[model samples]
Target: MSEKRPVFPEFDPDEVSSNPSDNRSFGDVVATRLSRRAALAGGTAAAAAFVMAGGSAQAAPRRGPAAGEEPAAAPAAESGRHGLLGFRQVETHDRDELVVPEGYRVQVLIPWGTPIQPDGPRWLKDASNSAADQEQQVGMHHDGMHYFPLGRGHRGGDRHGKGNERGLLVLNHEYIDQQILFPDGDEEMTGEKVDKALAAQGVSIVEVARGKDGQWRRVKSRYARKVHGNTPVTFSGPVTEKHPALQAGNRPMGTLNNCSMGVTPWGTYLACEENFNSYFGTEDPDWEPDTLQKRYGVDNVGFGYNWHTASERWDVAANPGEVNRFGWITEIDPKDPRQTPVKRTALGRFKREGCMVTEARGRFVGYSGDDQDGDYVYKFVGDRPWREHRRAGRSPLDHGRLHVARYNDDGSGDWLPLVHGEGELTTENGWKDQADVLIRTREAADAVGATRMDRPEWLAVNPKNKDVYVSLTNGSGWDSAATPRDPNPYGHIVRWREKGGDNTATSFHWDIFVLAGDPAYDEEVKLGDNLFGSPDGLWFDADGRLWIQTDVSNSSQNLPEKGYDNIGNNAMLAADPRTREIRRFLVGPRGAEITGVITTPDQRTMFVNVQHPGEATEAWGEPTPQNPRDVSNWPDFDPEGRPRSATLVITREDGGRIGA
Candidate 1:
């Protein structure tokens, strides 16, 4: 066990920086280099397209087939390529194991508690499930997801493979771990352990299927559902119904701290809402909390989900309008479970993590980030062409516009425009219209002068070129020539293009794509054995590769005195964005965190997700069954098991295509 304390909480997002006057805000100064094995020992092909992506060394740009597009050599990478990351990488190993690569073939699928309702009830070890049986099982940790096939075609469904043989995965249960969901693991606060930890925080879907022996199972359909955190959501654009600083109530509920996710070309399922100011609290010793709940970190012991000292609707001073209906962006419709799950709120709210979506200029944008640290970076767009506001039923994320992102150090940027009465929002700066600026979307993105990044987690796009990438994940003093890092402690990845490739271009141009640490504390990460660091989940694969994932928490993974123990656990790489190459394709287990990845539409069944594997075992405060998990019991090693997070599925034992 790596004896490092701080095992997450204090409403983590590696947090701290509610903008203490210019939390440094990218003034510029990042030009380091020489690692990735000293830039691959000076090899050629433009030094193998160099770009270790940190403070720009540049060289790696080839990109082909666009104007009149036609480059179809699909047995995997050929169109403009350095073999577009074709497998065989997997290295760093602290193995409590789910390693992958070597003809990959994983398969765990749906873990936390399983049972997608068929009168629920499966999973039960010593950890006795139940907050209504963890809301019909399955919900705990797994983050950012998407699959959806079930009788296909809404845009790349069945991906040319039998409507993906029945689908509907969905995912995102980003919370709950009261030491493996209670059984007196860390007992005491009740309301039935805060209703089984807000019934294991929101979003699930389930309905999988592939079984004709190709393996994928779990289909007790009625299109399986979950959505809880106090479910009963509803609300949409322009802050839903006249915002007077949003005093909303009348049964407004939502998608909870469900992290990393997005998907909707009308297929639905976005579920963002990171750290919802940790499930609120206040046993009122004179309850305080203003300055937008301390600029949205809200404390009084949350993150340890004391759900308001055992639930009074998570007492923010007795339901302060139930924490203004939770940090927005819900939108589920996993093939209709009677719809209901909207939120949207013009996609502004802070704590939102991933959103992605493309198709610019003719509208339908969407790009989101707001994951804290010096927060900001958003998009939105759509005032049309989301099938023209879903054929008049409205809600292309409530008739678009949002914006906010500034960057500039010469690499140019500016999307700015959180709009209210324009510039610095009006009504003497506290705007009163656009529903109080979409209910204080970070004080209307701190009234205009945006660019405060370094926490912008999950965002990816590349419908063959309008680019976009993201995953700032950590931060320090901020230098901003695209994440120049200060004390960043590994964590990078940024990319952009959008201007002429206009994803509704409000102007753009960026760099630094992949610098997630360790070339001996990163001289722009020189990938020796493909060492990795905090780049938290991204995705691209339709063969443009990208992929990446890693969270490194649990007091910074194996801690080599904090240089991140040779970067082992928490992995999942595969870059090659025009050959800046990156490799290691899967490594998660001890203390797991390689999260939500997707595939299948003939991308041959990938899936991923691991999450909270051993809950950072220092004997996880009494995780019994003869002290279950000192590191991991992953995908069930059942000695009365107790480490689960699960949903791997992998496959490629010749079925080909995953990461091809």
Candidate 2:
């Protein structure tokens, strides 16, 4: 990929808050990941290393927690009465007023609409946010986030071990829901609303300090910054220069719908652009559907957002070509706010939902999901070996070939390359060439028989086993069958092992790790003993404990007897993958989907987001008890109240590791 095609928010240090270094060690870890910049320059070295290590079939099977490496077990109260199935919620009466269990407390460090820049407009109810100013505000709908402690000044190591005082916090500001964002409607948003909403859609780079009082607060720091939608981002790797997607404007601008995020082994943050397709409008009405577009996703919608009617006419003003700029994995260096983020197009673009980086045979492997009906799962293999450049302070992310997965009838698969000039992709029945194929990757994946999946959302690699975990929602014809069977309808957590025992291999084996259902009675629908419903947000603790979160939208109406009938909303589950045992750990307030889980290094503090609590607008009210004046006041202070989307932090009643 080439860096010439810039398409992200520009770098602006003046827009950041100036705070002193409190967590230096944590920053060092992040800096180390960003510094190792050249190992990814060559692809053959990484490919060979995987082959030399012997393929997947012969490698040592992953092991679970060893005898003494585990933290002391959490007490019964924290673990819940149902043994492994219990989650104690935290209590708080902040802006987001949702309920948590006893003995827990949640702090709203940065709520939705919180300003990121110093002089940014305060998020008001009337919608005064603008695009020019959006560059200085916090992005909306915060989703997947990770808290990394800064390393000791420049000493390169785990800051948590050295009792470091300061650290850099990288959080993702996901999609901006137009309904609640703009005062009237998306079409009603004016200058300010548009700007504010755009600014709130990217990532926030801030500094945090653990006060002597034992609480974490946003440090009054210089590093507090917001990377808005219009930031200048460089394009790099694989499909960068040749694709029509990149051809949109010589350079694309802004990243929209950033959802599930990934932290590289090297340290920089990977912010994925999900649901970006909804932002673009087709200028070429005669735009014949490419075979690749038809296969991957792009064929359905014609006219997109009529930005002229809303705030900041990104569609009409800035660059109408701007829509194509989105939908790539953007890499950001949190340590140095001055660095420009890069859109790694080699990863393939389409409603990209998540990025999970893992290592096999000393190579870097990345797994991403396209969050659309019947989309395909894709992975990238770096060209060079993933050496301990981080130990030496460097970033190894430049070279890699993008490939899509195909689940064969025999239950095996191949990682078909989407590169423009080479592989089986070049000699196909359709595409002009490899570059043509990369531009329409979804279509190309279909050309190769890649298994279509239900809207694939978040993805997390199992820490202990090194298996890739993917969340598959409803399936569209392009990715899977419309009915519930092998891979559609009732989505499951799909896991796969790289074929060459290396992260960069072109083949792998896969299976449904866990299926979602109501285990209490729906045996036919539930694949596992601990049956649940629609699995969405997913994360793995340092100990490799797989935390599965749910996103059941319609509530009681969707699941009548699945135990979700008029009760607790979407819940979070902690499962031991090795044993295939899953237990509901925590549930959110009414009408909210549980998302974005991140833990401190010690695993003591867990942060989760409750998105759109009072989603059912009709459920909200005028003078009735059901209809609260403002849905913003949630996690309800009054037990019998409306719901709101807020961030919830959870920890043990005994100050121990969360899932220990």
Candidate 3:
């Protein structure tokens, strides 16, 4: 469903710009290919590495040396690699491996097979983990993560570590590789693989403390928890009580595909669920015109892996009616591991890729990306101002107005209302009404006319400028010759400054911050346009340095030979937003995507996740004889040797703050 431009609230394009080429600050002509097939194809290419991991795990050689064989190094301190710039790029590769500047060390905090629950089953190479046991262990495909200092606040007896303030590392288990994550493939997934897979797809909260030698270890604390498919969720907001699809005769269920996360102003964590719609396969799977089904991508019975064939199918195990629960932004209070997660249904559900908060007029404004081809961008305006009190009793998310954006042909834009009981969304237009608007929001946005964009993925707010930046993934409609307009072809990064210094305002001035792509592509693609292409995850460090991570997995054509061909794997770059200058900082291993970045408050430690390495191969048992040429045995198997999808710690050799 697409949103139509509403007549009530009028916007002036001329006031936003004067010259055609310079009218809109965003580069509309710098287009990327956008197609349903393209999106799926991209997933297939990226998912291949994970498939191989499964195949090799089952048939490969035995496990090697036990844990802790490597000696612990001194706590991170000043070293030559740390230099004046402060950050030194240590490891770089297209294959899956962890990298750190010299003088800094890297270690695996937790492995995919680690036992998290008291009774969680030990993971075996042949794929024998059970659903019930998995509920107690850590999930798979770890992505965005954040570390929080605990003990300073929390309930009684639950005070974590003492003087040192032992902390919690919250990770997002993005998705599962049915092949490697399981024993054989879906063919061998059996009862255990399905259950474990579901259990591994949510959030993993583990306690971490600096060991006796200054290394970090997962501390055995009551605060450690896992929220997955079976975990209960609370539905609160406009659509909670009335939306036809989500009503469930009661409330929503769990969260799936928790790709990226956000830290709220009040200190709670916001986990965004992406690709939730793909899990919902209906009873009458043949129903083509189903409204709820169409809006949420639930038309097919089984698109690839027939998860329904398994015992604990979320769509069927807890009432097919309950699948409506997965897409919204769910908030988790790390301090209290036992409390239920809240699905802020007010923020219309789609494939929520990223969620972020910025202070505006004292109130907190939440920004998010729907992560679908041509989907709209959204922001939530909280009713109350954010208080600095970090005590354990408050949650600032209760009330807010959710608005969808309409980017104009010119640089400026307006926020269209997706509120209940307002404008054409009422019960008058043969519609099921406002509740429907909140549940099947894409449809409601279409009825109102919000501008369709290239796949909207990650969002970043520049701490120095208060300007918002969004990574627009690759699009098919972005062809420069096909569209004539400077539509984002290879996808670009867009930015906007709130009007009159108010983020909660209904309108704002905007521009194309960086037209992501090869400078050799086209002069028009150049946007006076700063440099870059296919921008993905974005974050601003404490020192006002903006880190731009590229999602160029599909556009390898743009990269030059020599240093790039053998070493490039969707890198994380740093840019001075003030000067629009960007430099590549870190790269990922083969078949792996770099994600989930964070730096310690003092900037001494930088943590990052290398996801799904050595992706393109078949089952572990099938000998290389059949599929003669496939990349397998990732991170650890590389001729260079390493493990797939592991979190790494990066620190400056000189021991100053990162990016100095």
| Number of backbone-clashing residue pairs for each candidate, in the order shown | 6, 67, 55
lDDT of 3 by residue, 413-525 (tens): 68888865676677776457555676777766666666666667788886755667787755533322112223344566666666654678887654444445533433333
Which ranking of candidates, highest TM-score first? Answer: 3, 2, 1
Question: How should the candidates be ordered by lDDT, best one leading?
Answer: 1, 3, 2
Candidate 1 — which pairs collide? 35-38, 35-526, 36-526, 36-527, 150-167, 361-504
Question: In candidate 1, what are the lDDT values of residues 456-495, reduced to their tens digit?
Answer: 8888886555578888767663654445545576667777
Off by over 4 Å in 2: 1-103, 117-135, 153-165, 187-191, 238-251, 282-305, 308-320, 387-396, 421-424, 427-433, 476-490, 519-521, 525-531, 555-568, 617-632, 635-645
TM-score of each: 0.35, 0.75, 0.76
lDDT for each residue of candidate 2 in 217-242, tens digit (9 for 90 to 100): 56555667777676777777655644
Taken over the whole model, the C-alpha lDDT of each candidate is 0.71, 0.55, 0.58
Error of 3 at 461 (Å): 1.5
lDDT over C-alpha atoms for residue 462 of model 1: 60
lDDT, residue 239, candidate 1: 74
Q: For residue 108, give model 1's deviation from the true position in Å.
A: 17
Of 1 and 3, the candidate ahead on TM-score is 3
